[model samples]
Target: MYKHILLASDGSENAVRAAKEAVKIASCTQDSVIDVIYVVDFDKSKSDVLHSGSSEAIDIERRKKNSKVIQFLNDANVNYKTTILHGKPGPEIVKYANDKKVDLVIIGSRGLNALQEMVLGSVSHKVMKRVNCPALIVK
Candidate 1:
């Protein structure tokens, strides 16, 4: 029933599982499109660290994170597109979902930012509170 599925990943195991689940859900409809998003949350210190690094280093990190979801989508042969954006993960994801008018948002409960997560809770929780669509969070 989902026309557009948004899968948010950060190269985490939980995110990979979420991606796989999104793929399974999309498999039911040939016309469904899967959009994978990896947000570089500027609110986190981890992002500050990435910013301090060289541009090549930053691209390498982004590529590494994107690869996890990309590999799964490739193997599944799902019609999909990937996006890498910089912003606070929760709001950025919610905004993208709203802009795309996605039917479902699939995201991991935990991401790469452990310290900020403990202080502010997970991005998935924030996304759930913000997004208008159905959100499936994989722990």
Candidate 2:
């Protein structure tokens, strides 16, 4: 029943798996289009002057991740538009979905334990709280 699906991929294995599943569902639906988003979390660089090396390293890594997401779509033969947003991941994803009027969101959950998740708040959880559209969180 989904007409416009928004899939968030961060180049992680879990995200790749979620993308494949989302694609399969879109294929079944026949007329649906997938919108891919990769959020570049710039918040990690706030105090970057003290850690310039780490900041630069993270920027490079983010670029590589973005490239991987694009490559994955190309390999799958999926025609999709992509966005590289600078901000916190959750807000950016939710905002993009709302802005695009997407009917559904497919996001990957790495299934981190409570302690790990507390230390690094889960993007899926934050996006779920903010977005009104139905979200399918793939573990």
Most TM-score-accurate candidate? 1
**Which tens-of-lDDT digit does each residue in 1-139 have in candidate 1?**
9979999988778888999899889999879998888888776547646575777777776777678778888998989988887888888999999998899999987654777877977788889989999999887
Deviation in angstroms for 74 in model 2?
2.1
**What is candidate 2's TM-score against the reference?**
0.79
> Whole-model lDDT for model 1 versus the true structure?
0.85
lDDT of 2 by residue, 20-118 (tens): 878887877767878888886686556544555676676666668667656777787765777667788889999998988899999999889999999
lDDT of each: 0.85, 0.81
- How many clashes show up per model? 0, 0
TM-score of 1: 0.81
| Residue pairs in clash, model 1 | none
